[model samples]
Target: MNCRGRVSPGTAAPTEERSCSWLNPWVFFVSALVIKTAFVTVCLVVFLHGSDGQYKTLLQNATEWRCIPSMSAGKKESWTCCPKGWKRFQKSCYYLPADKMSWAESEQNCTGMGSHLAVITSEAEQEFLYNLAKGAATNAYETKYYIGLSASGNGQWQWVDQTPYEKAATFWKPGEPNLLFAEKCAAIHIKGKTDSNTYSNWNNILCFTSCYRICEQAVKVV
Candidate 1:
């Protein structure tokens, strides 16, 4: 009956008399605190070295976006980033591929790249796209880049992304979208002259017309 610290020959020790010091509530609390402190320390380290270490790795690997420092109301902020070979403007990235394709084909290509054809919703954006297309043009006079605008033969125009056709901005050339040629698709035509008007450079052409295309996508926020 005295099985305090020893067992008799061939006699098994009482199972209920085992030491349970490791099961103390204080022990569990200490272990949990230690684990929590370690996790916090790791997070702080990652945050401190984010510019060149684990934080950057997570952003790059997980979303392929970079956090760039910016300023707003005299306070520091971060700017969302675009992928390589893309140009960042405002809150979107623009891509102008050299290859030419029809309006539908260009839209499909942009969709495959996780974007849609460029939508010109402001004079500033229109100017930016016009300059971009001009720079990529082999012959400015003849170069045209497909945009996101199209018509349904009812003279009602619409963007490929369906961003309120009437409420959005328009940059149509004089007497454009004419029914003479049954033109339904819009493009940004780059004139060779330096004084060419950016606001009135848009022309509606046949949907099947082959031309360069501008693709647009929102920047990814990390």
Candidate 2:
């Protein structure tokens, strides 16, 4: 049949069918392009407005599944997080439970929670913990929290996590770690009152002495 005429008996098919067939590819192409554009637009809107901007920024800058806050000066992102009721600082999460226990018991408790007793390694960390303990203090003299430090039989101090002990980096109170007594474990004694020498609050006490504890764990990337 001709391009515009209907087919008669025993005639070939009309050109309209060929024309319709030729248009199918362009129609499909346009439909697919519209669907893809709509999908991208929806995704952009959700990303820009439906989610937290701060979290998005942190995720974008994260490396190897680690979030490092730019404001922390190369430190791990504090806001990236810790478990509920725990505090975040640098790359670690700290939990200060209210119940008191012996140094060994405290260490075991921390281990059960997939952590160790706090292994404080810097002045900033010391200060952070000191302040945290101070706020939880009900009594100035009794507000002691067990840390990860312990003394070996040979008088060598060691961290529960096996961090090397450095005398210069220690924050012991003046005249502390008295070898005269059998004090073998270290704790932070919060005086409750502000002092110029705040960071030097650590004291070596009897390992079996009951005190609160600080648990430390690395932050998990969500």
Candidate 3:
């Protein structure tokens, strides 16, 4: 007897579709992308002071949640603790080089922070600062810049605090700081023995002057 017409028992049509048959990998991938986009959008909106995410509450008082950058609190791009308007010089911060200013005005610029215009105590320190003053080379018009030191208060050669001019005693032109009645302001002068030291006159001095200013209390780590 031939069995050609009889169908096999084991092989048959597939059962009804799975309950989650539509959840293919590609479908899941598109769904995941959409969810991620929505989450990010919600975060940005909250950050920009949109719906306060507390949709359940009726009152909509704004809330602030700031996120700081990854840098340490005290440290910034190049210098540490640098505030606006100050440029970093060596380890300390300095004001931008400005034209001649009266001693009182200069004092005000530095007073709030307990820092003052630069002052040099030693010959070596002087050279070091002069070189610093020549920074970047373009806008450097003067080899000498004003510092915080002054004998302004007592009419005696001294640092800002009335300390005697001690350090490596500053060198001066023979007749410098003639202390002319009107010549209270100090300016550097060429110290060639032949040249007269006139307080009213200015020069590209080849020698340092005793009447110069020096800054106290530098703000830098050793």
The C-alpha lDDT values of all candidates are 0.80, 0.81, 0.44
Which candidate, 1 or 3, would have the higher lDDT against the true structure?
Answer: 1
Worst-scoring 10-residue span by lDDT in model 2: 61-70
lDDT of 2 by residue, 1-222 (tens): 213456899998765553345667888999999999999999987876653463453345333333433345776544465566778887798889999999999999999877899998999999998888777777554578999999888888999878999999999999998963499999998765554356888999998889999999988643
Q: Using lDDT as the measure, which candidate wins?
A: 2
Q: Report each candidate's C-alpha RMSD, comma-separated, in the order given.
A: 7.7, 9.3, 16.8
Question: lDDT per residue, candidate 3, 97-131, as tens digits?
Answer: 34434555555556644567554455555545444
- Across 27-139, the per-residue lDDT of candidate 1 in tens digits comes to 78999999999999998877868765534534434345545665569765655677778888888999998899999999999998888999888888889888887777774
Off by over 4 Å in 3: 1-96, 135-144, 152-154, 187-217, 220-222
Off by over 4 Å in 1: 1-67, 73-76, 193-195
On TM-score, the candidate that comes out on top is 1
Per-prediction TM-score: 0.67, 0.63, 0.40
> Between prediction 1 and prediction 2, which has the larger lDDT?
2
